[model samples]
Target chain A: MTGLKKTILGISDMKNLFQSLNNNYSIDLSNYALSSLKSRVEDFMFNYHFSSIDELIHKVESDASFFQLLLNKVLVETTEMFRDPEFWNFLKINILTRNNYQNELKIWIPECNSGEELYTLQIIIHQLNLQHKIKVCLTTLSPLNIERITKANLEIKKMEINCANFERYQEEGNLEEYFTNKANSFKLNPEIIENAEIISHNLFSDKIPGIFDLIIFRNKMLYYNPSLKIDALKILNTGLKPGGYIAIGIKESLDFPGWDQEFTVISESERIFKKIIRKEE
Target chain B: MSYKYIIIGGSAGSFQTVTNILASLPQDFSMPIFLCLHRLKHVRAGFVEALSIKSNLKVIEPNDKEYIRQHKVYLAPANYHMYFELGNYIGLSTEQAVNHSRPSIDISFASAAYTYKSKLIGIILSGANKDGAYGLSQIKENGGLTIVQDPEECQVKTMTSAAISATNVDHVLKANDIIQLLLKLQNKHF
Candidate 1:
């Protein structure tokens, strides 16, 4: 393991790197919460043996592949299937089961990382046999992440926690039933994502892909600064149909100004909110 | 020197020590306390309730981006790495765990050290692992005061011993003495 280094980047260094990335790749990370971003940038420097932020910027400007790796390193990907079992249970019983859809129920997972959450959602949909009635679209900034998630190979060690969470979420089945054990890892059944669409999209810089009934944008916003958070929320609001449901991480809240006016809290504990429909004045 | 933040990190056998420290502080304690104890990731509810029982000051697991308040105790939430952000707000992340622990002591302590610089007090208590050692070193390097529970008096000595080995920690005190030092600092006697 690489030893963690002291944070060496100052505010100006971070701004320069953000500016370089924006100019070269059109990637905008200016609004990420600074403290965590600084830590990650320092770690990246330490791991890759770069002594200065300018060296990192030079590499990012010169190599697109290295830039992709940087995206993978910078983005948070620590997620597990069926995490926060109580929230999953609430989502199943109170939201998914209760919603009555006439056409297809469109569910969007923006900034989908390594597919743990997507697989978890798919398992519930598979159990309910709602595959035909639902369409799931996953959007992420990293194409490598899209490939990795599509492959769906997970560490065998993680199964203990994953199984524990799955058991807590539902009573009857074993989580192991969903995957085939390999020598060192488990591969999720390909059928789980057979109908799911994976796209390389950036929520911050791109347009809203389509209107959706439910958006599971969990935990990703915790990285954004206040201004970016509100901007991202507005994009989510526009993509979600009025009366649609949006679920954030349990520890995340929609407490910023204008949130209450546009959305109503469905479950305060679980952080589920419903988009409010208002008549024109 | 006056302190603005009191950050504590512990695991394994440190709970009672922390409870005792929190139990000793009055409701109007001036500094905001940040506790980054290693906890079961799946179970989140009972720990805060258990700590709040003995604490005069309110003990909370703050939501992500929530503003920090003086006179309250903040516990790093389970399954997330807690950071002290700019503008005195709490930041949470589901990033990869460090030293096999989420709500990592190293991450929280380092962040606090960076944010508060010399206006921070970092303490490490009884625990079974070396998780907080690197973080305590960071606090010291940032010119903050550092303390480790007296290893001989600790229920588990590995954590404090590692911290002492990692840096020139300022004090190695027993549980009661640690509490007294905090109270002295609170009363502006230190």
Candidate 2:
């Protein structure tokens, strides 16, 4: 009984700490999932050797520089190249190679965390030899992530899955062809990085780029609240050109209200939707 | 202490045991249930339907960022890891599969333990893998209640035995006793 009460009290204390941080920093973290946020914050505290949440909160109030570290930790990127190989195959075969929108391709990767998805897209574009026709824009909210993406070095550990996914997609090129082996990492081809223009833009506050032929915003909605996701979907709708295909993570869906009015499912299994053209009067 | 959520994790040879337990649960069971059973990425359809065929509570395969409600069994959809968002909604992820299972039990259980703390009741059932062991330990560490299916009673004892070895479990109950415990907890609370 005492233990249960203590845990309840501990949760309340942690909530209060977050509330304090919100009030002081003007950073609204209510949109992030509490469990993930809590885990990240706890990890941050542990790394910094803060004995308690109150101590961490006190440090944040005292030092302005600590906020950036906190932000970097909280928004840590989790991505892998060629994740869900079948989806990549579908994009390559159905969208890229198909002659539907063959004039020129403008690809927007919103929330391209640390550039794995961006690099994956680049690899596909390279394979198709469509580099000249394709203009890629990758956007993220975190400057730290933008810097990491700019580095273009992927951890060597990800090679196993990346290789497996490539083989599953039956992708033509060898994996080693695009990367130079570093001591503990693999540096991506500089030409591919040059192809992408990485920008720092907040999904909530900043304006997205102009109409894109395809916008990939995979696995990002899971971090948001349901209402926030609805708003984000509405905003993302404006960033797409008519007939533009938008691919979300396979587990995600466009089931929000009025989603059907704007887009239709192009591939239900892969969760790709194409924007419908509504004639402007 | 009262629990706000019931979390169950299983792998091989668990479907029948889970269905049996779900069948015994009453319609008015108010605690939200999160289920993570290991399944292949390509096995995407009909899992919720199969589970709902025997369940009294609403059985659903939760979508990304969906608001969670009580008296509902939210099953982790294939190829996505399920986590609690803001302690009130379900968050689905396509981040690389852990333990070669997309809807990894450890990921969901760890997420649930962080959010609910002592207000969670975790159950580990029959399986071949040790995926749920670390997660059950996390739940127990957060002062939550944990029940491991008795290894002798499990169809495949590996998962259950691993869970028991990982932490000091509150109860080691077979399917029938587990069903009874859930009913008793329900009646005691609501």
Candidate that would win on DockQ = 1
Runs in model 1 lying further than 4 Å from the true structure: A1-7
Clashing pairs in 2: A34-B86
Please, what are the lDDT tens digits per residue for candidate 1 over residues B1-190?
8888999999989999999999988888879999999999999689999999989999999998999998899999999999998789999998888998998999999999888999999999999889999889899989999999999988889999999999999999998998898888878833
Tens-place lDDT digits, model 2, residues B114-156: 7788999999999998898878988998989999999998889
What is candidate 2's lDDT per residue for A1-281, written digit by digit as tens?
A: 23221121255656777687788877677666556556567656766777677777888888868977787667647667787788898999998988454577898988656788888889989888888888899998767677779888877777766776677667466676789999998898899768788998877888877788899988887766667778888888888999899999876778778789888888988889999987988
Measured as a fraction from 0 to 1, the native contacts recovered by model 2 come to 0.64
Docking class of 2: medium
